[model samples]
Target: MLSAGNPYVLPSVLVAAGAYLAATLLTDASLLVRIGLLAVLAGVVPIVLNRLLGGGSADEWRDDPIEDPGDGGADADESREA
Candidate 1:
């Protein structure tokens, strides 16, 4: 069975397969129509689906980004001295 939460990989594969089919089967279509279809199929649609299905902000997937206080900047010392 296929897994569910993969927002990028599956859709991308489907788009690639669909592009191959379109290229082979859609020769009678206009160049402008083919370009537009390929743009949506390979670029735009998968991106939109990924964003819609990719739960949570990117920050939530990582450790907190706070810098260590001991990694002192000149500003830290300057403020203390002042």
Candidate 2:
């Protein structure tokens, strides 16, 4: 559930700045080289940072335990059969 208010905001901003720096520093390179370098940084930085920071999945809500509706006998009988 990525949002504007996510905690990753600061790290993402830092990564963007670092990527810009790397891109500028390598300005003498060919267009293809620059594009490739930027692509790699764009792909790797967020993943690495997220892994290091233990950022939960974008779809983490799906992994949450769903509350039973407590429909009474139906759930109870099903559990008893198990």
Candidate 3:
């Protein structure tokens, strides 16, 4: 999910960083609390980014079906007969 081709990666990272900085600098939260905010943002930012980027399609994987070699096991059967 963190690959270079992923459109949401950069946005997620930036949002998570912003969230962390805001929680730390704008509030009087403790270290553990700020870390907890970061953790939650890390998990949720990607999902929110996905939705915002129009990546909510559930049938995306269906677009690419696995290719068959076209022999349908005939080559293996002929070799066995020999």
Worst 10 residues of 2 by lDDT: 1-10
User: Runs in model 1 with CA error above 4 Å?
Assistant: 1-10, 13-17, 23-27, 55-82
Give, for candidate 1, the lowest lDDT window spanning 10 residues. Answer: 1-10
lDDT of each: 0.63, 0.62, 0.70
The residue-level lDDT of candidate 3 at 65 comes to 59
For each of the candidates, the C-alpha root-mean-square deviation to the true structure, in angstroms, is: 7.7, 8.3, 5.3
lDDT at residue 47 of model 3 (Cα atoms):
60
lDDT of 2 by residue, 1-82 (tens): 2443345656665665676677678666676766666555555655666668877664666666677566875978999999
User: For residues 1-82, what per-residue lDDT tens digits would candidate 3 score against the true structure?
Assistant: 3344456666767777898899888999999988877766666666666767766343565576577657867897898999
Using lDDT as the yardstick, the better of models 2 and 3 is 3
Clashes of each: 0, 0, 0
User: Number of the top candidate by TM-score?
Assistant: 3
TM-score: which is higher, 2 or 3? 3
TM per model?
Answer: 0.43, 0.44, 0.47
Give Cα distance to truth, residue 34, candidate 2, Å.
0.8
TM-score of 2: 0.44
